[model samples]
Target: MKLSAETLADLHPEISRPAYDRSKVTAGILHVGLGNFHRAHQAIYIDDLLARGGSEEWGILGAGVMPADAQMRDGLKAQDCLYTVLEQDASGDKGRVIGSMTDFAPVSPNHEGILRAMASPSIRIVSLTVTEGGYFVSAETGGFNPDHPAIQADIANPGKPGTIFGAIVEGLRARREAGMVPFTVMSCDNVPHNGEVTRAAVLGIARGQDASLADWIDDKVAFPNGMVDRITPATTEARINHLREAFGLEDARPVFCEPFRQWVLEDKFTDGRPALEEVGVQFVPDVTPYEHMKIRILNGGHAMIAYPGALLGLTYAHDAMAHPLVRGFLEKVETTEVIPIVPPVPDTSLTAYFELIEERFANPRVEDTLSRLCLDGSNRQPKFIVPSAADCLKAGRSIDGLALASALWCRYCFGEGEHHEEIPPNDPSWDRLKEASRVARDNPAAWLQMSDIYGDVGQSPLFREGFTKALNALWENGTEATLQAYLND
Candidate 1:
C-alpha cells in the first residue's frame, strides 16, 4: 500500500504512526531546507513531543527556497506531508511515519509561498538546516560576508530576493510592520556558533536594507546555537526498495538513518517552543562546550577518514572504518591530536565519546558514503579539518596527522581514486582545487597557499612542513603505503 494519510492505518503492526490528532496540529514553527537530517532529527523531536500529548500548536510547516526543493515538496504533497523514517542499527530496524509537518508549501520561483509562511503570525519560530556552507559566513572570519555572490544578487534585487536570508529579512520586516512579536531564528546546522552565524547573515542583509531593521532584528530576534547529530546517508534506490520489501509500503524519498539522534540546544527561544526536553533534548544555558566536543571529535573524525578512504575507492563509511589502515589512522589522529585541542564537555568523557564515535562509524547498518563525507571540501576543511591544525599549532602541539588528512584531501582532489578510477568533482570549488592539486603534485606547498581556505593554518611552518611531506609521500607511495608510513612514523 502507498504511504499516505488514508493508508497509514494499514501499515505493518510494528510500524508506528502518529497517535496525535493531525488535524488539530497547527503550524508554529517554519523550518527551511527540510532534508533527510531535518526529517530524521528535529521533526522527529516534534513528533515525539506531540506523541507525549501536548504542543499541538507547535507543529511544523516545512518550506524550501532552492529550486531543487520543488521535487521534495511535490513528493510530500503526493503523500499528504507524511514520510516514513526507517531507523536502523545492529539490534533492530524500526519504521515510524512522521506527521509533525502538517504541510509543506509548494516551492515557487520567487519564494512567494515561503515568504507568506514566514510572515504568518502563527509561526513563532523559524529554524534552518541549510548546511554549514549555506550560511554565507566567511570561514576565515566566522562573520557574514556581504560580498557573497548570492548576497550580492539579493542586494541588487531586494524585492525579488534570491537567498534564504533575503527572504528571512523581508519576512521579519513584514512581521515588524504588522506589529507582531518577531519569531526566533534557530540554526540547527553543524557550523561552529551556528546561531551567531545566522544572526550575522540576517543582520548583514537587513542592514543593507535599513539600519533600523538591522537593529531590531539584532535586539529582538533570537538565534540559538545548537548541535545536531545523526548518520543519514543520501537516499539510495536500495533504501527505497527496502521500504517496499520490508514494510509493504510505497513511498518516495523515505529517510534511512542510524538510530542515534541527538540535539543540544540553548534555551534562547523567542515566544515559546515545544516540550522537546521531555523527548531527550538537552536544553542548556550554554551549548559551547558540547558544540566544540562534537565538532572536533565526530565531524572532524569524518573529515579525517573521508579523503583517505575515498582515495582507496571505499564506498561506504563503515567499509572505510573496517579498513585496518584507515581505522588506525583515525584512532591515532583523535587520540593524539584532535581530542587534545577539544575543550571539556560537562558530564561527558571525551575519550569515551570518541570510543562511542568509533563504534558508530563501525556500525555496518549505516551505508554512509565516503563520498558524502568527501563532499564540499572547500567549506568543510576550514570548518572541520583546518581548525584542529590551527588549535594544535596554537598549543605548540603536533599537527602531523591533521596535516596528513589535509594531504589526503589535496590528493583526493586530483580527480582520480586508486587504480585510476575517476573521482568526479566533489567540492563547489572543484575545478580550482583540482588545478591546485595538479600544481601541488610537484610543489606541495601550493595546495596550502589558498589563503581564503587555509588562512593562518597554511602559513605555519610546522603545518606547511608536515603537509608538504605527507602530501609528497601520498603522491609517491599511494594511499595504502602512505597511511602505513604515517602510522609507522
Candidate 2:
C-alpha cells in the first residue's frame, strides 16, 4: 500500500521494520540550508547518533534562507521530514531512513519564527550548508563583500534580515539580549578555513549594525573550522529509482552518495552540542592538515579535470576519470606540483590519499557530474588550484599541467567546443572573463591582470610564460593535444 500523506507508515519497513515514534525526537540544532550534501553527511551522522541511543538532544530543525530552500522544505515536509539515505560502496549500496530532522521553517514566511527558534535555550548549535557563494564572499579576495546588495539590505534591516549572515547575527543578538549564550556556528561548506570565513562574514555584517554585538559574537560564539568530504551528486529521477529498487521504498528527497563520509571539526561548542564524536565525527584541536590535504589534493584535482573533462565532452566525473588523458593530466598536476606544497596530513599517507581519491573517482555509481565540478571556476580556482600553481612558479618549477587546466577553463568560458557546449552560466563575472579571455589570446597578461583572481602570480614571469604557453597550445593544438604534450613533457 502506498503511504498516506501524514505518517509515512509505509516507509516503516524500510526504516528498519521496527515501529518507532518519530515525535519522540526534539529539535536542538537549526541547519540553515537543506541541501543534498547535508542530508547525506550531517543528518546521517545525527541518525547514527540517535541509533546509538544518545544525543536525543541533537535533532535537526532544517530551515531554508531563500526561495530555493522552499522546494527542499516542501519535499522533506511531504516525506514527513524523513528520507532514505542510500550509501554506495565498492561492496554495494546500503539504505537507511534519516529521521533526525524534526521540523522546517521557511525563512520567507517564518523569518521571525527562525529567529525565535534560534534565540531559544533549546537550540545549541546553528549549522550551515549554505554553499561558499551564499556567504556573499568576494570571489577574488575571499572576504565578505560589504557592497553586495544583500549585505547592504541585511545591514539596514537587521530585524528582518535577508542574507544568512544577517539572519545569524540577528539571531545571536536576540539570544544575547535574552541572556542565552550563543551557539556554535558550524559551517559544513567546502572552503579553506571555512569557520574563519564564516566568522568574518557574520562579523562583517554585524559590525555595520552594532559594534558591541560584533564584539560579543567574537567573545562568545564558537566558529569551528571543519573539513567535511563526501561525493553526493544532484539527485535525479534515475537516482530515485535506484534507491527505490534497493530499499523497496520510495522517498522523494532521498540522498544517494558514496559510502565514504568524513567530518573533522574543532571540539569547541559554547552553548551545548551533540555527542557527534560518538558517531564518527573527529573533534580535533586543528583541522588544518586535513583541510589543506583535501582542499589542495581532491578539490584541486577536481578543478584540474573539470574544465578539461568538460572540454573533452565527458559528462560525469567517473567518465572523465576513465579517460586516459584526463586521468593522466590530474595525476601529473597533483603528484608533481600540488602535493609538494601541502604540508603532510596526519595519520594518512598522501600517496594513499591520492590512490583513494582515484578509487573514489572511479565509482561509476556515484555519478558526480563533471559540469558541476566545473561550475564556479572563478571562485574555485583561487582556493582549489591557484595556490599550488603560484607556489610552483615561485619555486622555479614547471606548471605545464596547471596552465593547461586554466586555459581549458578559459576556453570553456568561450561557450564553444567539441561538445558544441554553450557554457553554462557560472560566476557573476563570466562576461568579463569571456571578454578578457578573447582579448587574452594575443595578450596573455590581460586575463592574469585580475589582481583579485591571480594576485602576485599575475606579475610572475614564470606563471605568465606557463599560462601563455598552455593557452596558446590549447588555442593551436586544442585540449587533447595539449594533454598529450603535458603527458609527454
Candidate 3:
C-alpha cells in the first residue's frame, strides 16, 4: 500500500509503525531544508518524542526556499509527510515510519506560504540543514557575503526576498511588528560554530536592510550551535525498490541511513524546545567541544578518504575503508595531526570517538558513494581539512598527511580519475579549481595561492613544503604508489 495516514492502519503487522496519533500532532517547528539527513536525524527525534506521548505541539512543518525543493514538497505531501526510515547494520535492517513532519508548504515562486508559516506564533524554532554553502558566507573573511548576487538581489527587493537569509529577516520583521516572540534559529549543518554562522548570516542580511531590525534579532533570536551526525545517502531507485520489496509499500521520500546517529545541541533556545533530551539528543551549555570533535574527526575523516577514493576508482565509502592504504593514511593523519588539535571533549575520549567513527564508516550496509563525499570540495575542504592544517602549522607539527590529503583533492579536481574516467564538475568553483589543479600539477604552490581557500596557511613554509612534495609524488607515481610511500614513511 502507498504510505499515508489514511493507509497506515492497513500496513503489514511486522513493520514498525508510529504508535502516536499523527492527527493530534501540530506544527511547532518550521524546518527549512527537507533533506534526508533532517528526516533521518532531527525529524526522527521529534517522531520518537511524540511517540512517547507528550510533545504533540512540537511537530515539524517541512519547508524549503529553493526552487529545487518543489520535488521534495510534492513527494512528502503525496505521502502525507509520512515516510519510512530504513536503518541497516551488519546484522539486519529495520524500517519505521516517521510522521513528525506534519505538513510541507507549497513550493511557490514568492515563497509566501513559507514566510507565513515562519511568521506563525506557534513556531517556536526555525531550524535549518541547508548544507555548508547555503549560509552565503564569504570564503575570504568567514563572514556573511553581503556582495553575493543573491544577497544583493534580496537587498534590492526586501519584501520579496529570494534567499533564505532574506526570507528569515522578513519573517522576523513581520513577527516583531505583530508583537510575536521571535523563534529560535537553530543550525544543524556541519559548519563550524553553525549557530554563530547562522546568526552572522541572518543578522548581516538584516543589518543591510535595517539596523534596528538586525539589533532586535541579535538581542531576541537565539541561534543555538549544534553538532548533528548521521550517514544518510541520497535516495535512489534501488533503495526505493528495496523498501517496496521488503515492506510491500510505496514511499516517494523514504530515507536510508545507518543505525547510528548523534545530535549535540547548545541549550540556548529563545522561546522553548521539545524535550529532545528525553530522546537521544544531548543538550549542553556549550557545543564547541563536541562540534570540534565531530567536524575535525568524523567529517575530516570523510575528506581524508573522499578524494583518494574517487581517484582510486572506489565507488562506495566502505570500499575506501576496506582499502588498506586509504585506511592507513586516514588513521595516521587523524591520530597524529587532527586529534591532537581537538580539545578533550566532556565524557568522550578522542581515541574512543575515533574507534566509533571508524566502525561507522566501515558499515557495509551504508553504501555511501564517494561521489557524494567528493561533491562541493571547494566548500568542504576548507571547513573540514584546512583548519586542522592551520592548527598543526601553528603548533609546529608535521602536516604531511594533511597536505597529502589536500594534494589528493587537487588531483581529483584535475577532472580525471586514476582510471582516466572524466570526473564531472561537482563544485561551484569548478572552473577555477580545474585551472588551479592543472597548474598545480607542476607548481604545487599555485593551488595554495587561491587565498579564498587556503588563506595564510599556504604561505607557511612547512605547509608549502609538505603540499609541494605530496603533489609532486601524486603526479609522478599516482595515488596508489604515493599512498604506499606515505603508509611506509
Deviation from native of the Cα of residue 473 in model 2, angstroms: 0.7
Residue 417 local lDDT, model 2: 74
Model 1 residue runs over 4 Å out of place are: none
Give per-residue lDDT, candidate 3, residue 21.
Answer: 85
Model 2, which residues run further than 4 Å from truth? 1-21, 245-248, 419-421
TM-score of each: 0.99, 0.94, 0.98
- With a 3 Å backbone cut-off (N, CA, C), the pairs that clash in candidate 3 are none
Model 3 Cα lDDT, one tens digit per residue, 30-63:
9999998999999999988999998899999999
Model 1 lDDT per residue over 345-410, tens place = 999999999999999998888788999999998998888889889989999999999999999999
| C-alpha lDDT (0 to 100) for residue 27 of candidate 2 | 87
The local lDDT score (0 to 100) that residue 95 gets in candidate 2 is 70
lDDT of 1: 0.90
Cα misplacement distance, residue 87 of candidate 2 (Å): 1.8
Candidate ranking (TM-score, best to worst):
1, 3, 2
107 Cα displacement, candidate 3 (Å): 1.7
